[model samples]
Target: MKSLRNLLLGAGILLLGSCNQAPVSAPAEPAPVDKAAIVLENIMTRASVRSFTAEPVSRETLQTIVRAGLQAPSAMNKQDWEVRVVDSQDKINAICDIMKKANPNAQDRFPDKNSFGNAAALIFIANEVSDQPGAFSAVDAALLAENIVLAAHAMDLGACIQAGPLRSMESAEAQAWLKSLGFSENYQPMLVIPIGHPDQEVTAGQRDASKAKFVE
Candidate 1:
């Protein structure tokens, strides 16, 4: 009985040693992702939104959009762009009045007479025209405008780009208003973006990639 008990203890010790010597397995690898496809989808799904709800956009979100706009590339890396955010109803109305005077039939041409669809906020993109060579200023401003609109879309906010309100800036009243808003004389307003909660849904139009020819 003593010999059997000793044999049993030896077997138990061997089993414990075997358990401690268990092998380690490597971690599973993550699945590969198609980043380009995701980006293309985001761009394709973006649409121009005209109607908007009364809900206002937060200052933090606006800042984020502005940051994205500033990240846009410019000719010779000039980055000569400025953004003005207008949230006051009185100022928006005053601008709209100026627009009406500039083009009395603007309402017939544009869906919203306000030129901003009465959005909660209007972002005006301006550029230092004199600093750019030829049309580079407009091109740079356009790139920034695209960045702003895309960023807004990514944040689930509705935005529309319009150059209609730019006509108002030609008037003395509008120029005075812009001056009061701290815009410099050399800065020219290129685009106006209205941001808010979307009141309508817009579908993406079909694109014909075949229009471009590959020489290679």
Candidate 2:
């Protein structure tokens, strides 16, 4: 019996010796993803879509886009910006009416009577006047608008940064409109963006890269 046990032990030792190997290393973490390239591609593909479908962006999607805007970098991180999302068709139509009155040429320029080009919603970014010198509240609002635009694009929505809305909102009727919408006197509109499902695809033209300079 002791001899049999020794034989079995020798056999097991031989099997282990034949199969002996260094611990197998886990597969190298899949090569790191090129996240930077993906981000750059997204930026490159984004275009200003002036025409949009009637499909309305849901509140949840808008909240996500606004959250991205809220994360945008601001001067001193003061974030002196107020965003008003006008989804009310009546208010949007009123703004269009104001635009027509403000710019008689709007109709001539745009194919549609509505100068807004039938956007599903209007996103207004107002710069709250900051007391800090060189606070650059307008710049902060501009950054916020950029973030909103990018976020909208990422979500398969189209957005265009329009200065026309603010211009139209300057009239007495527009002021009344703004007041009705609850914007304070200090909340001066800096940018008005219209976002919705894109009705048409826009392609980017070749950029004029000659004007750029790089310094070490």
Candidate 3:
């Protein structure tokens, strides 16, 4: 009987030791990121970049920016907008020449005759006149234009919207050039977006909050 009691006590001690052993655990996952906050921060930090490096923007990046522009809201869901992406230096130079010819004094108004920062590409937003009236189409194009710039900024690319190029498209020669760039005669260029890797840093200007009055 003494030997049996000793054996039982030894078994109890081993069981207690096993119970006290540390448990095996699975690896922990990373914390969830706040996507909305990230997007809002991107919007706040966006600035108009007028100067750019010589590095060209890739086709994939340009397509992504265009996708973002198409995601913008349009009037009556008509989506009356067309985009023309011009990346060729020759084509850009031709357009710039037309601009200069259209307005001989454009140089005085703009720092560069191109007014596009000599970006890797130029995105021209035009209205699809058949789908909507000119006034409504213009508003729709403006919304799309903002989306394009914001998308470019989000992707660490610089972009600027200049009226000089679009305004120059009003001339007869400029209109002919537009047709050569694949824009239809019915479509009217509303905005010109120049995109590339930025060469200079830009700071946001101050806004007057008082100018915005809440009716409610």
Candidate of highest lDDT: 3
Predicted structure 3, TM vs. truth: 0.79
Indicate the TM-score of model 1.
0.77
Of candidate 2, the 10-residue stretch with the lowest lDDT total is 106-115
Model 2: how far is 175 from its true place, Å?
A: 1.4
Q: Please give the lDDT score for candidate 1.
A: 0.81
Looking at candidate 3, the ten consecutive residues that score lowest on lDDT are: 106-115
Candidate 3 residues lying further than 4 Å off, grouped into runs, are: 1-27, 108-114, 130-135
Model 1 over residues 49-158: C-alpha lDDT tens digits? 87777788888889999899899999889887888988887898787787677777656324653567768788888888684345587788889989988898888888
Give per-model TM-scores: 0.77, 0.79, 0.79
Model 2 regions lying over 4 Å from their true place = 1-32, 108-110
List pairs with backbone clashes in candidate 3: none
- How displaced is residue 120 in candidate 1, in Å? 1.4
lDDT of each: 0.81, 0.82, 0.83
Please give the RMSD of candidate 3 to the true structure.
Answer: 10.3
Could you tell me which 10 consecutive residues in candidate 1 have the lowest summed lDDT?
Answer: 106-115
Query: Candidate 3 — what's its lDDT?
Result: 0.83
